[model samples]
Target: MKTLQSTTFKAIADDTRLRVVNLFVTSREPLCVCEIVDALRLPQYQVSKHLTILKNAGLIIVEKDGTWGYHYLNENNPLNKMLFTFLKKYLVGEVFDDDIKRLEMRLLLREEGRCVVGFVDEKDLLIKIKEKKQELLVKE
Candidate 1:
């Protein structure tokens, strides 16, 4: 399990990966791959690659309902024990800002047992909003 712990830590070592983890932790909802990519303002391939690493390290799990794959925190994952302990001891003053919270709530509202393209569902309107966030982040 040391290998797993090491791998998870390495995967989360990058700012992007750390942000992704924080997003997942604060959202408290199963998130689609596209949602993660959009929220993080990352290229689709980059997001997918990092997600694969996290999954391999046993830090996250993916659930596929049709073509949409939703990723969520793995409570039973051994890495989570370490992550939670670390957060409890060190991340006390952290908060999910308004933008992140808004993104999370929008994603939550889009869930309907399966993933659908944003244009296909009225509830998926949040996709446009997420895109705006990407634009803003890129400018920074």
Candidate 2:
């Protein structure tokens, strides 16, 4: 168990991994890889790399829905739950504030509360999101 704890600690040691965990803590729903990419403004490859580490460390679990894979904190794991609760309080301010804000925006683009906007490029997703926001504004 000590080895597992060490691996978990090592997984979250990186700034990006910590930010990802913090994002999960703040989110009301599980987030897909594309949504994570959009929120972080990081390449999918980088996000995937961090996700793999977190998964290997037993910090996260992934679920497949159709073509998209959604990631969530490993709630079933006692250690993960404990760590996530700690993260929820510990990581407040600039450490992950911007990423959380961006995640909120990314979630707004969801269609029927599901992550359907899979973007190969961040710019394309931004354009679609802008159009969707304008449509909502016009409707109001």
Candidate 3:
């Protein structure tokens, strides 16, 4: 019942929330909370806090599978989809670029389309991403 237009606007007003939205907006598959935490380079608590706000605003939904919860944008609502379209088109800059880069790299750690590694430290995650990129480059 809280699908008020103002609710969505308020939820997305924070820069961090926008970055979270960007992840769900652009991702091909639902993301684990750990993935979002790694991508945003923030603590799990902060990411979870933001996720709670987004969920309350009805812009995203989370589905639990075993011990993990996969989150995706709420495309069921036209407004939610419209907001994501705008984020995809207009969210730009180094911060946004870095977020996407980290996420795409983190995704490489997935096993059989599911996140197997949880809560990697920032430095190790970056190094792994770089190494993975190098491996892909060598193969090509």
Q: Whose lDDT is greatest here?
A: 3
Instruction: Tell me how candidate 3 scores on lDDT.
Output: 0.86
Q: What local lDDT score does residue 23 receive in model 3, on the 0 to 100 scale? A: 83
Please write out the lDDT profile of model 2 over residues 1-140, one tens digit for every residue.
47777888899899888889888998847889998887887888999999998998888899999989989888898888888888888887785899887888778788888886775355565777789989889989
The C-alpha RMSD of each candidate to the native structure, in angstroms, is: 8.7, 2.5, 3.3
- Residue pairs with backbone atoms closer than 3 Å in model 2 (clashes): none
| Model 1 lDDT per residue over 1-140, tens place | 46766776787887666767776776666777777765665677888888888888777899987877889888896658668556434533334354365455456435244444432233455675577577768989
Error of 1 at 91 (Å): 5.6
How well does candidate 3 match the true structure in TM-score terms? Answer: 0.86
Each model's lDDT? 0.66, 0.84, 0.86
Of the pair 1 and 2, which is ahead by TM-score?
A: 2
Q: Enumerate residue pairs that collide in model 3.
A: none
Clashes counted in candidate 3 amount to: 0
Off by over 4 Å in 3: 1-3, 126-140
Order of models, best TM-score first:
3, 2, 1
Instruction: Please identify model 2 stretches exceeding 4 Å from their true place.
Output: 120-127, 133-140
